[model samples]
Target: MQGENTSVERGIFIVLEGTDRSGKTLQSHNIYEYLTAKGRKCVKINFPDRSTSLGKTLDGYLKKSIKLAPEVSHLLFTANRWELHDYIKTNLQNGVDVVCDRYSFSGIAYSSGAIKLDFEWCKSREEGLISPDVVIFLDVNLGLSSGRSGFGGEIYENIQDQSNVYKAYQKFTNYSFWHSVNASQDPNVSL
Candidate 1:
């Protein structure tokens, strides 16, 4: 078995996850830029994509425009990710990298922790999903993070909800792929 040769693709699926305004979008863009600079094929995508039907409904729910049962909303979030599964696989199989602003982790952390939904149930929703090659957790000082521009506007923008989401994210850090970055540092440094 020592000399066996196996062909493994080079495409990498990366996820940048954190609470609201934790620089995930910015970091995802930076990673995409780095990949492009190195001439690697890459695609950057965000969760609750807001373009698809399910995403549109999820957006409404997030914006407080529509109300859905906790369980229903959670499933919709999972559905949004599922819709992208094949697309993600296609890119990966083609040696194209995928950098995501959020993934199933957020679906579970935000949806369940921000509310009373069971964490186990929330985690279950993401079961059988494609695991990221890397998970960058942009951790930030809650007090400092809350003071950043544009706070307290969205449905789950409150400090309490953010705190809960932060805690929920900690649950999965035991995984070796998770990398935590302290975002409270200078922007140039964090990047």
Candidate 2:
């Protein structure tokens, strides 16, 4: 749906990236509902999709059931995104908006936090992948996140790792297209 004087000329790719437990899942659903109620064609997708083979492997690793070298684990993370590359592109080509939860940003952020993985090295795996038209990073203090529900379901869910992820997330602030929304406030503050 387009406003009288506004337009979405084509498909819009909007991605939400944040440290673990930043309320992204909840916010993304709300955004999807708001857009749909306004009659916009949209679909929500999540990374490490967990439905594909690579995603399954990543899931196991995150669950701490599978072991991998830092480099290989991070590459699997990138490959998980690659698995959905064409699906995302096709949605955009068809004029359906994509509301994605996570992307290469998460891949590099989480992976590079490890001493063994280079930031640029993690990025190299995602070269040529589709870029989002907009990236909304939910910035929140790890201290604030510690109080949220479901905080420790995965391996990287702890405060120490989340703090490091926050540091990595900050690096993207230099990019004009990256929008950091302070998410420590009540979830409905802006809605």
Clashes of each: 0, 0
TM-score per candidate, chains pooled: 0.92, 0.91
lDDT of 1: 0.89
Q: Candidate 2 lDDT (Cα, whole model)? A: 0.85
Candidate 2 off by > 4 Å: 1-8, 188-191
lDDT of 1 by residue, 39-96 (tens): 9999999997899999999888888999999899999999999999999988998889
Off by over 4 Å in 1: 1-8, 188-190
lDDT of 2 by residue, 102-122 (tens): 989998999877433788887
Report the Cα lDDT for residue 176, model 2. 78
Q: What is the lDDT of residue 189 in candidate 1?
A: 55
TM-score of 1: 0.92
